[model samples]
Target: MLQLREVNIDDKQTFDKYITKHNPQISELNFTNIFMWRNSYKFRFGEVGEMLCLISVPDNDEPFAFEPIGAYTKEAFIQAIDEISNYFKEKNWKLVFKRVEEDKLDYFKEYFKNGIDITDDRNNSDYLYLSEDLINLKGKKYHKKKNHLNSFTKNYEFEYVKLTDDLIDECIRINEEWCKKRSCEQHRNLYCERLANLEALTNFKKLKYEGALIKVNGKYEAFTVGELLNSDTAVIHIEKANDDIRGLYNAINQQFCENTWKNTVYINREQDLGIEGLRKAKLSYNPVKLVNKYTITCK
Candidate 1:
């Protein structure tokens, strides 16, 4: 028997324990945003023993149920859906599922084939899939990336350090500088809150073992933090570079992929959020593939 329950960050120990045991990379998702979102919006939960399951539905909508953040067996997923459907049916609201990632298409396919309307929302920008086997480029492609890295390394001492409280503070300073120079207009408060949450989480040594900081000329220039999504996948949560430094972004990005994620078969750089410049930057990497996502609504 499965039961659903809402999550509270006050119980961070239990929440973090589950994340570390099941999926540590999803640690980024275990933030105040999720807590606030779940608080304002009612979510369905299924509990089996110590394991807790989550299913999100729009607060304004009564019938729709979004998928859970944690992984589960196909049978468990289906059972969760059935439970949500029954609850929504009683409320007379049509059920809708949004932002289903491409990897989980089979789950939606099973239900859609039975007569549910599925639509590709195309909400996210192109996702880049990096090959684990670093491209063996001998000519232009190889030279271009090599030149930038070499130039960055020669001019600035490349230092890859474990993420620490001091490193995070430096990252914040660099990020604020970049934002100011770029005249970033959106999500200023949200960004600050997210960074604060990230800083707080970084203190958990076990959870943030993979995060790194890149310093140039003994000064913080860039930083990135991420974790293994699964056995073969690593997902980058946050990456920022000093805007004043030339090629710092390229240098840190390439180095991180070359060093930290070299063992992983695939690197999910994640979504670009439909930002034009960001989309182009991600596309420029020449991803091996793209993961398409979709949304489903019952008519």
Candidate 2:
């Protein structure tokens, strides 16, 4: 039998255990975000013995529920969805599953059918397939990217290392400077709060064991952290670069893809969130394919 239970602060250990056992590399769904958003949201755990399904709902929202961050078999996924839909219906709520992954679209469509209204929000995530064989690239494409990388390497004597206590302070300093210049209140506030929460930051660092930090002239300029989605895939959770530099963004991006993800076959850069500049920047990379995310709203 399948049952849904609310996830509370006490369930942290269990949640982390589930993540560690099933998928250790995808750090985006770490306990930090779950705890950070816990008060503003509610988590429901669908369980059948050792298997589990997680669903989140924002405090102010009633019609929609965020996608489950954890893993589940297809059968368990459908069962959980059905049970959750019934629960929502009882409460007079129309459940909408947000950010449904492209690969699971068919499953959702087949199961939800006429009961749920499916909509493609037109947002897409770009993913790059890494190849250790540099010879696979076309002459023109290969030359262009190589030229850009070479230029950045020659211009900046930067170092990429694991984010440590000493270097994290530099990342905050650079990030603050960048935010101040742009007058980005939202990012600045969130960054400051995250920094102040030592435990959360520590947890993030722990989860991002393979994260990289880029320093130019011994000063932090950019940083990115991610986890492996699967044995062959790594997903970047956060990437921030010094906006003052000309090619720092491109350089770090290329470096991480080439150097950091050497063993992985694919890199999931996550979504663009419907931002024009973000969309354009992601599009310029010439992604191998776009991961289409959808939302299903019950009528």
Candidate 3:
């Protein structure tokens, strides 16, 4: 079994050394994603055959590995997964890989054949959009979205400001009210998401985040955080708005893209998690493609 260590804020530099070199598609490939949800997922990392290996052990579920980061060769990956499988066996848990990106799916199918089940995890797949489409909101497809942004612009005295550490208090205030309205206290997933939000904001600069916030009618109402996932795509880690104010969500999203991410070709808004309303909202923007993630389990 490979030795592993807990993921910490200080480990960002170590992880980014591997991640930045790889061309990652899914949102999970970034350190911020792992670091922010470290509480729920309990992520640990170590090197196997010189490739960075990651594993998640949730408090309520069986442990599983993610696709190894850094350079890939069939020999190195096979050895890494083999070691990971044995590590899980020692703990008496089945070998599993969750959120495996599409490009790496072939490796598992060809090398680890027997008793392996590979299924698409649609609920966790990322929604990718053309940065231009999101920023410009051009044509008939964006007619409704354009209207919403226009309404917010015309009605509210709003300022689109850079999300800095000084505004953390205002961000927290909006989040507290948003959590109550969404009934996050009664829902496990929502509660986990709330914690993720706090984790991102608290470590904003350390995580390499570039974010934006909307001040509507002299009050802080909405904000979003995101970072470059790879050479071409920027993934949004968090987005929150005061739902009581119509079009605030649209304003925050549009302003963030227009102001922060125009240099990137694609924007990864991330998954809907099988939430009906969330799915509808993401779909309304018309994603260019869906980056499908898969889960593989050895039976």
The TM-scores of all predictions, comma-separated, are: 0.73, 0.76, 0.97
Q: Which runs of model 1 end up more than 4 angstroms from their true locations?
A: 1-65, 68-74, 87-94, 112-114, 125-128, 131-139, 182-206
TM-score ranking from best candidate downward: 3, 2, 1
Off by over 4 Å in 3: none
Task: Specify the highest-TM-score model's number.
Answer: 3
C-alpha RMSD in Å of predicted model 2 compared with the true structure: 4.4
Candidate 1 lDDT tens digits, 1-299: 33456665455565555444454222224433344345345545554333444556644544345454445567766766666666666766677766555555677668556676667754443354554433332356457656766677777777877776556677667666666665554765444444544543445454444567787777777887666666667776667887567777776676677778887777667666677787877776666666665667765
**Candidate 1 residue pairs in backbone clash:** 3-45, 3-46, 3-47, 4-45, 4-46, 5-45
Which run of 10 residues does model 3 get worst, by summed lDDT? 107-116
- Cα deviation in Å at residue 181, candidate 3? 1.1
Best to worst by lDDT, what's the order?
3, 2, 1
Return the TM-score for candidate 1, rounded to 2 decimals. 0.73
Q: State the displacement of the C-alpha of residue 58, model 3, in Å, after optimal TM-score superposition.
A: 0.8
Clashing pairs in 2: 25-227, 25-228
Kindly report which residue stretches of model 2 are placed more than 4 angstroms away from their true locations once superposed. 1-51, 59-63, 66-75, 124-126, 131-138, 142-145, 186-200
Error of 1 at 135 (Å): 8.4
**Model 3: per-residue lDDT, tens digit, 118-215?**
99999998999999999899999999999988988998999999988899878877887889998998999889989988988888878878888899
Residue 132 of model 2, lDDT score: 46
Give the Cα error of residue 235 in candidate 2, in Å: 0.9
Better of 1 and 2 by TM-score: 2
- State the lDDT of candidate 2 residue by residue for 137-169, as single tens digits: 346646665676677789989987776666666
